[model samples]
Target: MPYASLSEYNFFEGELKNLQPVYKVIPYDINSSLFTDYAIKKRFIWMPKDVQANYTTDREVPVFPIGTVLIKNFYYDNTIPNNTTYIIETRLMIKKADGWAFANYVWNDEQTEALLSTQRETIRMSWNQNGTAITTNYKTPSTIDCATCHTINNVYTPIGVKPQNLNKMYTYNDGTKNQLSKWIEEDYLDTKPTTINSTVDWADASQSLELRVRSYLDINCAHCHSTGTSCDYTPMELSFSQSTVPENLGICREPIDFVTGDQQYIVSGQDIQGSLMHFRMNTNIQSEMMPPVGRTIVHQEGVELIEEWINSVETTCP
Candidate 1:
């Protein structure tokens, strides 16, 4: 349940568990999150009896009413003997009278509460995943930085709440439930579209490589790369859809300012080293990376997948 007033309670204190039940826990097929080494969990909450979100077709994100709230928690397992999960921060999106308001609460040392913070913090974090010791600074996005990608068409919209992204099934305490269907039954969402276009599960090797790579790019880069954004200064249109042009997809396209490898090809087929797309994605440098911020390390698996797709599609770029 959502708090009646944005000022009513201290969200930084982990008040969600005591106030009301969870509205919904929505997971994405592929999520574009802030660069961190930990697993993330997301949930939706709304003021009781508030208007439900409206559905749409053709790859549009769902529209939520005033008083709606979205919550996301970033956490990781403690490497100590008990291996307890520790939450680093919790982000909230509340639909106020003015529109969506963004806030972040940083968890305290005790883990019992998090405090509202306006500035970004770098938490030196370490974890053992499959017995591999991994460590990194978990960067928390400042409240202002939250709007950088979330602001679409001049509005602070939730990026991943689209029909296509939320079309998957989830396992819950009661049972397995299809998110969209459950949303409808709970009256948390309205107007089911006849057709919901779901993107590819990028890690699934059985799916089409083209669809997988394009879908990955859509979430990871399309927000800034779409028309009218600063990235649009370049010719690339990374949004994955039927109408997207081949050149926009970086087929034989060339970077405007910087040289790609030893050649000019933005995506030199079968040549990952020569492709600017691969080069930028594989880098963590502040100025040269495709995503200028929010990530400190390259997503090696994602780069490999895109490289495989590029290798299979074309032999050369002219």
Candidate 2:
């Protein structure tokens, strides 16, 4: 079911009926979607007939054979139990012989179609979210911008497709079931570990605030912060599985790029006002903001969550 080009399939139309049954619709725990954007859905499809993906018992991400296709759709919804939604964009990740290739399609004004574009563009959109009038410069990233976050260790890889992130339960048409087990049962995954470590479900109130915050940072920032990546020179390790030690997690640490504001970069045991992490997360200004791309609006909810977490802890670099 692989297409020679992204335009070959009319996925933005009603073609989902054909693809949904063939592809494995997957979900992640933390939900790394941009703020102001409601509900992001993902599906993974393998092109090779009768070839299932090999599962990893070593905790590394399972590598799919060439021709694997990963699809993600973004939408903006207006009200409770939203009856109407505006399609924002759709992104596709294809595994080629050389490596993974990326493409992004911006949905049309009619919402019935999406067009593949080579240049990044912004679509000014408006919606009534939670009874509040909201407007955003919905960003459609260029082909090159797609590589910035996907590339790891000089290789393009799919983030959040790892076992730990995908080890939770997912609700299908049949019923709710563990995603790993479902994948194995459906023959999408060859095999999986008997016992798998799981990342936190950020929206679940039962989990600790610390766990939720860490999970958020792991999926959202670890791409560049991990060893050998763009931010490798820094000491911070935002990986979810990393040790909870202060130094490893950047508590009470000084800014790496000499970003001296009125407060310390990450005041280990301080409130939002003095925490540099809080400052950076609160703004979208280049050189001051994190995740430098894919977002034109600040994620207020995420910023508030991190702010609360930072204020709850007390740590010192010394």
Candidate 3:
């Protein structure tokens, strides 16, 4: 049975507002992350004592033991005069004997405690972003919505926590160390391979255009687009490993379904105007946006990145 309140788990120490993890609940972060209307996220993982997760593959999620809990908290920093912060939600995925289970906790206005809720909600919020006041109605997804993107081959699975995404260094209370190494140190993970095909930070412009775009799609679209998932029927495979093939990226391939206008190919090389992928990313229309549920507004920076990448493609479809 799920706990009625998040506080019942005792995952945090002292004041819950501070988000300090208790003893064995280890904090972590991924390299490339999905965008959720620019909400800041804090992630942590806790597992049963003496039981460590087994490594499957660099690109796949580790095999966690039963009773493991993956926690993620979403919030926004208000840039107003008071500089107040508002925590929106905390989502937990617990590994059970059967499979993984979802538990979403909606924070209260007092910022004191969050209660488990399966109901969908819209939170109208405003915040300052780079000197601009931005307002949005952030949608909190229900458990059903959570399963939509998380299910693979009819089984609920995690998107992040893969070795490729967690191979980078992170600063802990002790000092800075590689996250995978930190996991080993805490006895939360077993088996550290010599080589890891790591994922790069998508927002880092210093990386190659291909690397940045591939990393972005791997995190944002691959969860549903890869094999045995939601959009597997589509020809495009956006996972970093599969995306290496031009055909998988849909460079010159025709889209299975028409999206609108003269967008003929899923990704029309060197033609942003004729690319369906670019069209979907650049729009905020409910019926047209890619990843449909995550954001209400367009990811302008991500769109720009895709546009730049599309323009750099040298191949032309026959």
Candidate 4:
């Protein structure tokens, strides 16, 4: 659907394979090795001869609109036959035309397991020609999240760690999928938030959440939140995925955070207590935000979801 194989569809070394209709991919995520991803530590070695030509040079078109194609028909349930709940991220970073792979993780039925099982998201890349209205190559993705990944760019930037409105594709949460703008589209009261929980087979997700969440936290917040880093002493080592972190996104790591007493940086459960998530969401000058470095303002829904999830955590984290 989205990729020729599973990971990236490499065309850098060889010829363009299946070039989807220009419109198939949204306008903004057109990052073709041209822009500088400040977070990228290693510069890519291979480059296509006509990297720029791939797009339609017309001014109004943004990028050229050759044709149209539908990679993933998210509309249809079970289009993804696997009983495993999917944690798919729209990773657009393609490596050497040939060096493309992805991770397709599997969650449990009803999707309530340890996190390790879903440590990896389902990732895929390809090298197919963009032809007609639809293609089935999407079924056999090569790899998972291993090949494709996020750079250190700020959240709001094109090359940020957090998933932005990339590829202009539908935004993916655990249960629902929709266009980012669609959330506010039409009447706000139109379609209420749907309850779309995932369904995995069994209890295999424990390790998935543990390892994957750790890996994610390592790549994402770990850079600055680790020992000796900005958040010294306080060891969150928190993770998110198929697994369940005790406080979820709580600022349990910091005792006095945004709180009145002891003078810590955040409070675990209280959003108003200046929890790390809350502070990160704050753009006001009066608020002492974190990362004060890269990343854009935190996603409001993400913050609220984390807060709600924290409230849902059992007193004991199994």
**How close is every model to the real structure, measured as TM-score?**
0.86, 0.88, 0.98, 0.29
Cα-based lDDT for every prediction: 0.68, 0.68, 0.90, 0.29
Report the lDDT tens digits of candidate 1 across residue range 214-275. Answer: 77887778777777554677768877663146677777887785743465777777777778
lDDT of 1 at 299: 75
Q: Which is the leading candidate under TM-score?
A: 3
Q: Candidate 4 residues 217-292, lDDT tens each? A: 3334543443334453444533223124544333355443442234243434433433454545444232454433
Q: Which stretches in model 2 have alpha-carbon errors above 4 Å?
A: 1-7, 10-39, 42-44, 57-59, 79-83
State the lDDT of candidate 3 residue by residue for 1-318, as single tens digits.
479999999999898988999999999999988999988899999998989999989999999999999999999897345568999999999999999999999999898999999988898878887677888999988999899999999999999889999999999999999999999999999988999998899999889889999999999999988999988998899998888898899899888865666888999888999999988888887888887887888888899999999989999898
The lDDT, on a scale of 0 to 1, for candidate 2 is 0.68
Off by over 4 Å in 3: 79-81
Rank order (by TM-score, best first):
3, 2, 1, 4
Q: Where is model 2 poorest over a 10-residue stretch in terms of lDDT?
A: 27-36
Clashes of each: 0, 2, 0, 58
TM-score pick, better of 2 and 3: 3
Which candidate comes out best when scored by lDDT?
Answer: 3
Clashing pairs in 2: 269-314, 269-315
Candidate 3 residue pairs in clash (backbone atoms < 3 Å): none
